[model samples]
Target chain A: MITLKDVNKNYSSEVSIGPVDLEIPRGGITALVGPNGAGKSTLLTMMGRLLGIDQGAIEIAGMDITTTKSKDLAKIVSILKQENHFMTKLTVRQLVGFGRFPHSKGRLTAEDEEIISRYIDFLHLAELESRYLDELSGGQRQRAYVAMVLAQETEYVLLDEPLNNLDISHSVHMMQHLKDAAEQFNRTIIVVLHDINYAARYARYMCAMKNGKVIHMGRTEELMNNQILTDIFETPIEVISTPQGLLACYH
Target chain B: MNSTVALTPKPRTSRAPLYTAKLGLGCLLVLILLALSLLTGAFDIFSGEEGREMFAISRVPRTIALVLAGAAMSMSGLVMQLITQNRFVEPSTTGTTEWAGLGLLTVLFFYPSASILFKMSAAVAFAFIGAMIFFLFLRRISLKSSLIVPIVGIMLGAVVSSVSTFFALQTDMLQSLSVWFAGSFTSIYQGQYEILWIVLGVVIAVFILADRLTLAGLGEEFSTNVGVNYRRMVLIATALIAIATGVVTVVVGSLPFLGLIVPNIVSMFRGDDLRSNLPWVCLGGIAVVTLCDILARIIIAPFEMPVSVILGVLGATVFVGLVVKGGANAR
Candidate 1:
């Protein structure tokens, strides 16, 4: 369980993210969907303890995130941000291997290595495991980063816009991977995504934000209605049922 | 169950233990080089019977100065690069060395006969303040352009160097300033070289904070997330770098590019884990300095060229190599 009590983030005179009071349940995929500058990234970062909260507290899995030591928090929750820009050269396996830093402290044990290899193969990155991150295509690099997060083996995975720079097929594959990780491992996956359709189709729950506040949050089906979607996004988004699941079309 | 079992492959450590071995060997090589440097000198101190006064006074201190200055400057460069997330930055490149030079000039002008310790303290403090100013300027510029960072730093260094030059000329202290600027290890002796121990203190502090420093390199938000105090880390790192530069400048004069070259070379062999690669950087530094010192003594045959000139040529060669390699492998 992750609880936010009166959390607020104020960057400048005009910019403030929250004074939000909310609780996230123990296990499920919660899709944070909103427009640009809607505090989606800021709120996600705060939950991950990546950004400090100015006037409130956050607790993850019965532990106060603020007071918890980072080495321990890293074991419970792992986060991957939107962009991964490292000047040094690293192969996919090498990059993913760093996921075990919290556990192994850079000296990887046999078990840690096995887990790293599993995540790599799970992401279909075997062919590119030896390739440097900079040498790979955008989609491949994105997958590599995702694999690294998965290799972290944390119960809670926080990813901010994991689909950015991915192609349509890779995007779908990534969503499926997240869903699988959530279902199989019982991991609590919190993802910030732009595509409402993907959120509607795969997410068990949805949290909608606007100007730093959670305007609407509920089950996927309940939150996919036309009136709620249109009102939240200020656009006419029609909900439709496809063969796979529910989808929201904003065009 | 069978499918999942088949799917999961055994994990293995990507980094080899031999990498550690290589680093250890590198350190051993540096020690050997240092020993050789202690034994050899300008007056053929090794050839005669019992060691003479020149060996005790000139040769030993000069060698110690080279090793300390080289390692400290290179380590400072590594720290600067890690903090700024830019490979091109170094103490010299970022004006820390020039700032120290300016500080030395001020002391010379005001309290010409100040103790070596007093002169070094003044230089270290001024250099730290200058580095902090540059850091603040970086913070104020919201838009981060990597190229502009080094350009701004170099320009700042040039401005400070010019000020020092102008003052030196006015006070007829240009001779002293010019000699210091040339970065010669020749004049270092026992009494003068103890000031460089301050750099060893900085090195110890750096080793203690190595993991946190590595965390800081990942970016500000990430560093904070990982429980590293970013502002504090930057302040500590900047202070260490300035003191390292100041001590080196006082002991052996200014050795340009010693800072930039060693870190890059070490990073090429080892990955960016500062803790692991630090030993490699320090070793590479000692090796380069010892070799350069040997060449500096041997090349002119009884008349020694400054070690900085040797380092300048060597550093330029390595830097050009890196640039060419970077261009060839442009992604």
Candidate 2:
């Protein structure tokens, strides 16, 4: 389990997120959904220890994030942010190999290479493995980065806005891939998703945030209602049940 | 698996043999130039005992200094570029060499008879501080483009150089300062050039940390997420750059653009994996400097020109080409 108690971040006098107390249970996908400036990414980054918390503590799998050595923590949690820009040119395979750095320290053994290739193949990037990252299309590059993070072999994977710039089909494919990884690998995946429909369809649990606070957290069904999402997003959101599933439409 | 034909199979298929051939050719060129540099000086190596004495005292020391300074400066530029995530930056552009000059000038002003060790230490200290200041300044502003970094660095360097020039004029050591800043291997000797050995040690350290440094170049969040201690790596890189710049500045004066151009050229051909690219960068550095030093010797015969002038013209031309290509790509 990953636990956050009184977690707060004061970016400035005007913007702050905090006093959040929550527990994200292990296994299954938890989608953090809300409007812009809702602090979903902030909370995810804090859990990943990419951002510091001012007031309280975060514990991932019973180890405090702030106290744990970064090298050790890396073996437990892996995070992929929205934007990853590299000044150096790197191939898809080489970028995935860096995911093994925490374990092998840049000297990848046979086992590490096998694992890297497995993630590459799993992500359907075998064709692009030798291609440079800059040469890949947006969707392909996003999958490549996700492959890299998954190659870390960490129990907890946090991705912030992994679907940005992806077309609808690619987004659905990526969500399916992530859902399968969560189930097959027995990993807890927390993803910040902008599309509430994807979260409703794929996520087992949902955490809604607004003004830097968790407004609601429960099973996907419980948070799928019109009242809660409307209150959380501060917009008129209508929930309609279709043949497929419950969908939230704010249009 | 689905059949997805490789779009660029030829580049991959031809890379290994091409890399080997390039390495072989570079080594051959360096050897030829080293021979030319050693044999073509004012004193003929074909002569008897007097020639042997001259070779040992002047030619050998000069050659060693060129190799050490060249390789170290180029590697230092690569390290700076990685740490700063900017391709245009080098020790000269970053005010590091100018700070060393200022430090040397301060030593000359206060302690006219100061030992070389004292001068070197002072220069290293100043260079370290100057690099730290540049890093801190970079942290404060969000850069619009990579070109802005070197532009800012050049401005910083100009500011520091003016301060050194001001002090030189006041102390009436303007001629001495100009000679120190001109960067020539003409005065290098066995005893005077031994300080560059410290740079050799620094370069070795850089090699050991090459992978980590490359990771650090990927930005702080990514590097830290991958378990690298980003701040510590930055500190280590800063120290390496300062030491390399300081030693070269004190020993052979400032070889502007030698650092900037060699690594840029190397990365243009061999990608940016530091461990693999480092040797080529060093070899390129040594080869370029050896060629420039030879040109400096032969272009005016025994009169000789400073190697910095040749490097500056070459570096500027290449830098402009890179900038133009980069701008076109961005557009």
Candidate 3:
């Protein structure tokens, strides 16, 4: 379990997040969904220890994030931001290989190499393994980045909008991959998502935020409602039930 | 199962032999350039006892200096570029060599009889400060363009060099100062050039920290996420660059573009895998410098030009090319 206790971040007097206290249960896909400037990304990054928490502490599986060694935290949790721009030209396999760095300290043994290849193949990037990142298209490159994070093999994976720029099909495929990764690996996956429908479909639990404060946190079933959606987003949003699943329709 | 990740017939590391062969070829080319540099001097070492002594004292030391300085400077450039995350950054461009020159001048002004080792330490110390100031200062400024980084560095170098020139002029040691930092192998002889070997330690250290350094190029958050001590690696890289720049400045003067051009050219072909590119960067450095030294010898036969002139022209061309072509990606 990951716990945030009275966590606060003051961007300025006018802009701030928390004193938030929350508990994230272990071993399921939890999606943090909110509009822009709602601090969903901020909260996730703070929990990942990518951002500093001003007033409180965050713990992952009983280990304090701020106090634990970064190297040790890397073995337990891996985080990926959306807008990754690499200066170094890396092939898919090589980029995935770097995921083993925390464990192997850059000396990739045969085991590390096997794991790297596994992640590459798992992401269906085998044909593009030898191709440079610059050579890959947007969707393919994003998948490659996801493959790299998966190769980290951390029990807790924090991803901020892994589907930001991807088209519809690629986004669906990415969500499916994350779901499979969560179930098969028995990992705790936390993601920040803008698409409410994607969150409603894939996320077992949904945490909704508004104006830097979490509005609600519970099972997706409980949170999917027209009134609650409108309240959290502060817009006219209707929850529609279709043959497939629940989707938030806002027009 | 977990072991089933490798689904295809192609094994991992399939490119190992090909990588080795390409590296071997690059080394072979550098060796050939070394031979050419060794044979290109004005004096005839093919004659007698006096000629053989001259060969041992001057020609051998000069070529050795070229090899060591070249490899060390280029690798230093690679390290600095990765640390700064700027393609154009190198010792000369970043004011490191200018700071080293200032240190050299300061040592001579205060203690005219200071040993070469003492001079090297002062140069290294000052270089460390200069590189740190540039790096830390660059971090605070949100640069409008990455090209502005090297411009800022060059301006810093110019400012530091003006101070050096002023001090040298005041002491009437300007002529010696110019001659010493002239970036030449002309003054190299057996007893005077051994300090260049200090850079070999730098090369080895870079080899040991190659992965961490490369991760640094991916940016602070990325490397930090992967468990690297990013700030610590930056300090280590700066120290390495300073040591290499300091020692090379003391021994062979300032090879202005050697660091910039060699690594850029190597990266053009080999890409940015520092661990894999270590040998190629080293060899590419040796080849470029040795080839330039050979050209310097023959260009004005019976007299020599400092190798920096050739390097400056070549480096400026590549620098311009990178700035122009790298427009979209410079940010």
lDDT assessment of candidate 3: 0.87
Q: Worst ten-residue run, lDDT, model 2 chain B?
A: B9-18
Candidate number achieving the greatest DockQ relative to the actual structure: 2
DockQ agreement of candidate 2 with the native complex: 0.48
lDDT of 1 by residue, B76-123 (tens): 999998888777788877888889989988998899889888889888
| Candidate 1: segments with Cα more than 4 A from true spot | A10-19, A54-56, A62-72, A91-94, A101-118, A121-131, A151-153, B1-11, B18-40, B46-53, B142-145, B320-331
- Tens digits of lDDT, candidate 2, B1-331: 3535345444321022225777878878888888778876766766899889889999989998888998999999999999998888999988999999999999999999999999999999999999998999899878778888888888999999999999899889999999999989899987889888999998899888877998999888888888898999999999999999988999999888887888888877766767777878888999988888988888988788988888888888988988898898861
Please give the CA lDDT of all the candidate structures.
0.82, 0.88, 0.87
Q: Over the stretch A1-251, how does candidate 3's per-residue lDDT look in tens digits?
A: 88988889998988899978888888879999887899998898888788888888999999999899999999988899887876677677778888888999888888898888777877888778888898898999998988888899998999999989889999998898899889988889999998989999999999988888888889998899999999888899999898889988998
Q: Please write out the lDDT profile of model 3 over residues B75-192, one tens digit for every residue.
A: 9999988887778999999899999999999999999999999999999999999999999779887766778889999999999999999999999999978987889999999989
How do the candidates score on chain B by TM-score?
Answer: 0.91, 0.93, 0.94
Candidate 1 vs candidate 2: the lDDT winner is 2
Q: What CAPRI-style quality would you assign to candidate 1?
A: acceptable
Off by over 4 Å in 3: B1-9, B14-19, B327-331
Of 2 and 3, the candidate ahead on DockQ is 2
